[model samples]
Target: MMEAININHFNRHKITEADIIRRILSGEKELYEILVRRNNQKLYRVIRSYLNDEAEIEDIMQNSYIKGFTKLYQFKLEASFSTWLIRIAINEALARLKEKGKLYHISERAEELNKNTILEIPDKKQLNPQDKMIHHEAKQLLEKAIDQLEPKYKIVYMMKEIEGMSLKETALALDLTLSNVKVRLHRSKEMLKDSLFVISHDTHIFEFGFSRCDRITERVMENI
Candidate 1:
């Protein structure tokens, strides 16, 4: 199929992020689509970690992408593009929070007051319709619990656990020390009920699906 051939062609000549940036800077503006498609899910997760409103999240994502494109010249090739982009998205989220007077201090000591707990859900590969419904409900419960966590822990959880970023990458993106990243991740797990951790790995949570992905990609491409 054409899709398979395209996939093969892409794999055979995969471009590095830095290379894409270089080409984009050199006037191959269309290459920016590659970056937008690649990082859409990540940007969504990071922004969602701060604000729950879907419309607002998409607005901030658009602003972040436009800002990133305008400031692309300042981006250093030595650094991770995703990390740099995430920092911008985080800043945008924080600014929105500040505007709404919702910005709050993040204190490690405050997290210490919460007791550790764990919740488990059944995991089965082949499920009847009833079992599938139960699984869906369980995942929803886990998502709600994650949503209730303090912003400090929630962002770490989103990046490290949901997004599957390395501890170092998470630290770099968040501008936290490695130990701080580890501590926050550990604390996030504790607060989430360790047993529910299985669901994160097995199922998609906080998904940014294909339709939305295409919309963001098209919009960013249009503006940039």
Candidate 2:
């Protein structure tokens, strides 16, 4: 199949992050699109976990990318490019939160959104169209509960649970110790389980669409 050949070709001609970095540093600035497209979804989720407003999230992302590109010369080859970019985005999001006086310390933000509400568990055996609608509603409720968490725990939970990042990667992005990341994630999970009765894995929360990715790429390219 043509798809098979294309896959083989891509594998054979694969580009490493270091190679792309070198080319961009050598003045092929447009190649920055490669980085933006690759990391857009992860970075979007990272910023969204902190701020609820979509416009604010996008503004933070734009600022982060511009900051990253300007500081590209300072990047060390020792760290993965994705990891480095994630750290930059996280810092920008926190800084914006602070500027708006919306920031709270981890301890302060951990004050319970709701301490004693028991949630109803959805039955799993049902596969009818009605069940599907209920499933969708359940997912929305889960997302709402997650959004109520403190930013520290929210970021940790989203990174580990939704974005599939390893504990080490989550710690690196947030500049927390491994133990701290684990503690926050554990507490976050407990909060969700207590509030939702069950976490839904059937739907993605806070997805970044292809149109927005393309728009972000275009905007970053123009600014750089």
Q: Name the best candidate (by TM-score).
A: 1
lDDT of 1 by residue, 1-224 (tens): 11335434544698788888998899877777777877899999899999989999999999899999989999998778999999999999999999988899553433433345444476667598877987888888777777877898999999988988899999999999999989988988877655676677743788889899888877887887
Q: What TM-score would every model get versus the actual structure? A: 0.88, 0.83
Query: Model 1: clashing residue pairs?
Result: 118-193
Output the TM-score of candidate 2: 0.83
Write down the lDDT that model 1 would get: 0.82
Q: Which runs of model 1 end up more than 4 angstroms from their true locations?
A: 1-12, 105-120
Consecutive 10-residue window with the lowest summed lDDT within model 1: 1-10
lDDT of each: 0.82, 0.79
Q: State the lDDT of candidate 2 residue by residue for 68-166, as single tens digits.
A: 999999999988777898899888888887998877745443566565666665665887888777767877777887887888788998888888889
Worst 10 residues of 2 by lDDT: 1-10
